[model samples]
Target: MSNQHFLTLQDIAPQDLDALIDRAITLKAAHRAGEASPQFPGSVMAMIFAKSSTRTRVSFEAGMAQMGGHAMFLSPGDTQLGRGEPIEDSARVISSMVDIVMIRTFGHDIVERFAANSSVPVINALTDDFHPCQLLADMQTYREHRGSIRGKTVCWLGDGNNMCHSYINAARQFDFKLHIACPEGFEPRADLLENNSDRVRVFHEAQSAVEGCSLLVTDVWASMGQEEEQARRAAAMAPFQLNATLLAAAEPDALYMHCLPAHRGEEISAELMDSPATIIWDEAENRLHAQKALIEYLLKTA
Candidate 1:
């Protein structure tokens, strides 16, 4: 344990990152066994959200309460930053009042600013560029089902959004092989792609991406703030949809995943999501346990 902040998956080293995933799995088992965790008894956490979220909000709040801690949800409208106050001042002020800060926002720079100015640990719940928390849950789910993620092929379909970026970050730490399928212009940013080592490969065809994949993942065609381009995105991503035919291209035992709030027919087919191979629900539930492990680790270690 150390004074650390989790702003992205890449921030966590290989062994430490694996430990967090293992801790998350253990916490989830404890919860299912009706055991209680008072790891943060009497502590308080702050969640600053500039973007609206369903999973991120619920999971972190419930996780804090479950660990005998309280969580406060602060929207942009509730903070002085909305009134033009500097983020540095807000971060310094909030850090003194809470044990840790969790932020979900539009800009990666905003989270970086909060981390830079804050005394306590800061986590990136989500950003336009990365969703590290979501990838934690996804990685935990992968390990639980497959025993290990090292060397496993996880194919990503649809737009190269935040989840894809975080997955690539995680891939760098672990041995998981990543193949991302996107339309010509919809591929992940070239700068991020260049940072990857030998574990990742990009593909223009969905079939090629899923060829030998152990897991198949997809996200909504349009993420928040991208709704204006939904029609164009949908048309360009039509061929990347996760359906029965596409799933057949992967390994026989390949599992399926979606960082939910899925757009039924857009990024995935209903039949595929309803199938037994889909671990979407389990992955969603793991978000709570994963965040609990993360919060407890940050508060105790930091």
Candidate 2:
């Protein structure tokens, strides 16, 4: 095993990714059966958040406790990094004191620099450029409900933000076809799309992208830091909302997912979010199991 950093879905090999998902499933079952493993007894995970969170913070903190490890939360106000400390300096200091580090921040380069200087494994909890951890949970939930995502067509029907970029990575790593539908200015990073052109396609109409797709997904119309643009985004993205009509165009058994903290009636309608086709709750819960598996993999591998 070699030291590694999970900055993106592309960080791990296809086989390892598959194995991690399987491990997450097994761990989830064990958890339900009241069998907790002390895989990282006495270890510590330092969680640094420049960006605020609910799922990322809770899931990682709770997962660590369940695994017999402790997780320390460091907010921007509490850490010098927020007060102008270089990312490399902060990474060196924090990683030395913890067994693993998880960072949820703005720039992708922040995590990159931290990982470059860290002594322990680094996990990208989230970033403006990619949210790989969420992708793990999404994949696990899909596998649990459907099956292998390979060869399946997945439609992303909202802001081409971090989640969208991670989905593009997922499509390539998991061997699936990704149909991304976002408003013109909201399209995912051009370099990312070009890198996985064979596996991903972009569209301006949600209906067209969802057609024949086995999985349909979306995110909030305006993500964090884009709050002021909510009204404008809502108008621009109105045509791309995931509603009953749009969902109807997808495969009959198609599953709908949202990374959540969802804005009902914005990116997706409330009725549609509550529909039987939606597996968002399961996707949310998988975050715990998937991340536990990830922590175990990183620690053990390291």
Candidate 3:
């Protein structure tokens, strides 16, 4: 794990990613039964958060405690990283003191640069370019509900943002196909689309994109740092909302998922969000278990 990082879904071997999903399911069951594991006692993980978070912070901190380790939270205000210190310098200092590091930040390049200079494994908790950790929980949730996602069609109906980018990578790593329904200017990184052409498709029509898909996912149309553009995005992305109509376009039993903090009635309808049939709650809970397996894997392998 020293040389390895979890900045992207591609960072973890495809086979290993599957294993991590299964392991996360196992860990979830164990946690519910009051099992305590001391697999990584005394381990110290540094949590660097440039962006605000609820799930990322709580899951990582709680997961570390459950695994007999400690997590130190470092927001921009609390660290030298915020005071204009070079990323490489901060990485060298923090990695030297910690067993591992996880960062949720603005730019994907921030984590890449930090990982390049750090000695310990650096995990991208979240980034403007990808949200791989959430995809881990997502994969686990899908695995629990319908078994392997390989060969399945997943409809992503929203901005081709970080979550969509992760799904693009997930389509490759997990051997699935993805349909991205985004507005003209909201498409994901062009290189990702070009690189994964065989497994990915883009469309402006949600109905057309979701046709015959097994799973449908979306996120807030305007993510953090885009508050000023919310109204504009809302207008442009109106057609892509995950309502019953769009859901009906997919397979009858298709699962609808939103990587929470959903804008109900915007990217997704409130009825669908609260529907018992959907597994969004399970998806959210799996964040802790999936991250625990990730931490265990990195520390044990290193």
Candidate 4:
């Protein structure tokens, strides 16, 4: 619990990341067996959303309820921060009454500033720069199906947005090789790629990146704030779409994953999404188990 905020996966040690995945597995099994321990009775978690979400919101709220805790959802319209209150002021005020806080926002710096001023732990549900929580569920799902990700090759196909950036961090933390394939102008942050060059590589061709990969992942071409660029991105990213033919380029046993709210025929073909290799449904479900372990870890209650 020394770390007050989970703004990015880079903030966590490699060993801790491994432990969290293991804890998530244990918690998941316990939950299914009706043996879960309610470790946060009377606790409260504040969920602040500057960006709307389905998975992030449902997972956190449901996880809190399952743990015997309460979750309060606050949007820009519901909070004074929408009216120009400083994020620091809102953080201090909200954290004072809550046991934990999870923020899904635009800028990465907003959560950093909030965590710096808060008394309780802060979780980065998502940001334009990183989506560590989703990575947790992804890694858990991978391990449950294929064991340790260490020494494995993962292919990321599509936009170099939050999910891609988080996968870069996951490669470093999980000790795996990551090959990222995206359109030229849509590459991930240069600093992030440079920092983890030892484990990450970028490619313009999705086929080249997926060759021999054990996991193939993708996200929408245009993210929440990039709706205006839809047509332009579609043109640039059309060649990189994940389909049966493109997936065949990967290893025969490679698993397919996507952070949900996927565009059926944009990032992936409709048939590919329902293909046997796709484990996206499990990946989505793991969000609840993974976040529960995170909450337990942050609260020192595990």
**Backbone clash pairs in model 1 (N, Cα, C under 3 Å; residues 3+ apart or in different chains), count:** 0
Q: Can you write out model 2's per-residue Cα lDDT over 163-195, one digit (the tens) per residue?
A: 999999999899999999988998999999899
Instruction: Pick the winner on lDDT between candidates 3 and 4.
Output: 3
Which has the greatest TM-score? 3
Task: Evaluate model 2: give its TM-score.
Answer: 0.98
Each candidate structure's TM-score, on Cα atoms with residue i matched to residue i, is 0.97, 0.98, 0.98, 0.97
Error (Å) of candidate 3 at residue 230 is 0.7
TM-score for candidate 3? 0.98
Tell me the tens digit of each residue's lDDT in model 1 across 1-302.
23488999878788987899999999999999999998788888899989898999999999999999899999879879799889999998999899989999998999898899998999999999999999889989988988888888889898988888888887888778899999999888788788885788899989988999989998998999999999999999999999889889899988889999998877999897787657899999999989888887788778
Report the lDDT tens digits of candidate 4 across residue range 1-302: 24457889887789988999999999999999998578889999999999989999999999999999999999999889899999999988998899999999999999999998888899999988999999999999999999999999999998999999999999989999999999898899999999999999999988788998999999998899889999999999998898888778988888889899988999999998887757899999999999998998888831
Candidate 2 residue-wise lDDT at 18? 96
| lDDT (10s digit) by residue, model 3, range 1-302 | 25678899998899999989999999999999999886888999999999999999999999999898999999989878889999999999999999999999999999999999999999999999999999999999999999999999999988999999999999999999999999999999999999999999999888899999999999998899999999999999999999999888889889988888887788899999988788999999999999999998888776
Residue 76's lDDT within candidate 1 is 77
Candidate 1 residue-wise lDDT at 20: 90
- C-alpha local distance difference test of each model: 0.89, 0.92, 0.92, 0.91
